[model samples]
Target: MIQLIECPRDAMQGLPEFIDTAIKAAYINQLIEVGFHTIDFGSFVSPKAIPQMRDTAEVLEMLDLHKAKSKLLAIVANVRGAEDALRFEEIDYLGFPLSVSETFQQRNTNASIAQALETVETIQNLCQTKGKEQVVYLSMGFGNPYGDPFSPDLVAEFVQKLDELEVKTISLSDTIGVATPELITEIFQVQITSFPHITFGAHLHSRVEDINEKVLAGLKGGCRRFDGALKGFGGCPMAKDELIGNMATEVMIETFKEEGYSLDLNQMELEEAIKLSNSIFL
Candidate 1:
């Protein structure tokens, strides 16, 4: 069975207009009822950086978790953000982006690669203390346009360090959609084989035409966890001039179904969420 993680926070984070807190909570609440394994619903970062998600805490309070079966995950860029997210018992995971591309690492987190590692160590310790799980996203995991050196070895080394820190889950993020099917297969296969204890996920960004190929490659390489957004609403604004939206959840669901992967999703609830998604993103 493949685990699907729906990422509404990634979809809304880059929007120029502010989404009402109530609306955000309502949409997320519907997603919870749809029965995804987890929901990446919001972030606990500086308001100045992502003004759209400033109301994450408030939105979280409004979610009707009484009957929702999905676990909640929140994105955090620093230790401060992690601390804020930790205060909420509703959040089951804290996601932090740790880019291997030196240029993107500084641009995304305002910290160099070394500094980001230190932050990860601190955040990891904090998660352990609080009895919460931490998910590290290796941004630019496939490749980057900044001309920074990237290879399977570099990625392996970074994953080794993360494994040493007892990081249980790491998502290889295609920040700029530069990954090819071959690259995706190779990287995921190596990571899965090398770290048997660590759970690896694919957080891919891709053109609509390339979605199935990318997803297939990841699956073939031993990845059972995937992250995507409804209708593929958002991408990393800092990566390029034009945004390459996230992996569309609808596409992933359809593909998995055709491939005989049982996802345990409610089609009625998913359709309702998709309809609601248009009102939010369109």
Candidate 2:
């Protein structure tokens, strides 16, 4: 079965206005009932960096997790954020973005590539000690517009480094929605074939017109995990001003169903969550 990760935090982070903590928790609580494998629910970053998510801990307090089947994953930019997130025993995974592009690395995390790698090693150690897992996102896993050097070989080398650190899960991110379907296939094929032990995920950003092709390409390249947001709502604010939306979760579900892939989702709950999204995003 494919693992669908609902990313409401990613959907909301770049918004200019702040969402109410109660409302954010209500939406995520409903999503938890939809039975996704995981929910990318919130982050532990600085309020200055992402003021929209300043209430993540407050939101977590409101979630009704006693009956929740889905795991919670929070994004952390550095070891400090990771430490903050670790204090919450309810959080199951910590996500760290490690960009292959030097320019993006600094822009997104305020750290160079070397510094980010060291942070990952430190966070991985914390997770191990705290009994939590880490999910590393290869931001700019596709090409970038900053004139940064990029290639399939470069991505493979990063994978090797992370693998040496015993990082088990990595998501290839199309940070600015610049990935072609061909490139998606080629990159995922290389990483999956080369590192059989690691679980590869696709966190693709795209225009509505290109969503189907990109989703299909990831599947064809042997990726079973994917991250999506309702209605394709958000993108990386640090990447650019004109953000490319996330892969729409509903569109992905449609494509997977048409391809004869079975997903373990609660249709009734999904419909309710979609209704709530209409209210929250506007």
TM-score of model 2 (CA atoms): 0.99
Query: TM-score for all predictions?
Result: 0.99, 0.99
Write the residue-wise lDDT of candidate 2 on 1-282 in tens digits: 799999999999999999989999999999999999999999999999999999999999999999888999999999999999999999999999999999999999999999999999999999999999999999999989899999999999999999999999999999999999999999999999999999999999999989999999999999999999989999999998889999999999999999999997999999999999999998
Candidate 1 stretches with Cα past 4 Å from truth are none
Give one digit per residue, the lDDT tens place, for model 1 in 6-124: 99999998899999999999999999989999999999888998899999999999999998889999999999999999999989999999999999998888999999999999999
Tell me which residue pairs clash in candidate 1. Answer: none
Which lDDT value does model 2 have at 158?
A: 97
Task: Please count the clashing residue pairs in each candidate, in the order shown.
Answer: 0, 0
Q: In candidate 1, what residue range of length 10 has the lowest lDDT sum?
A: 235-244
Candidate 2 Cα outliers beyond 4 Å, as residue runs: none
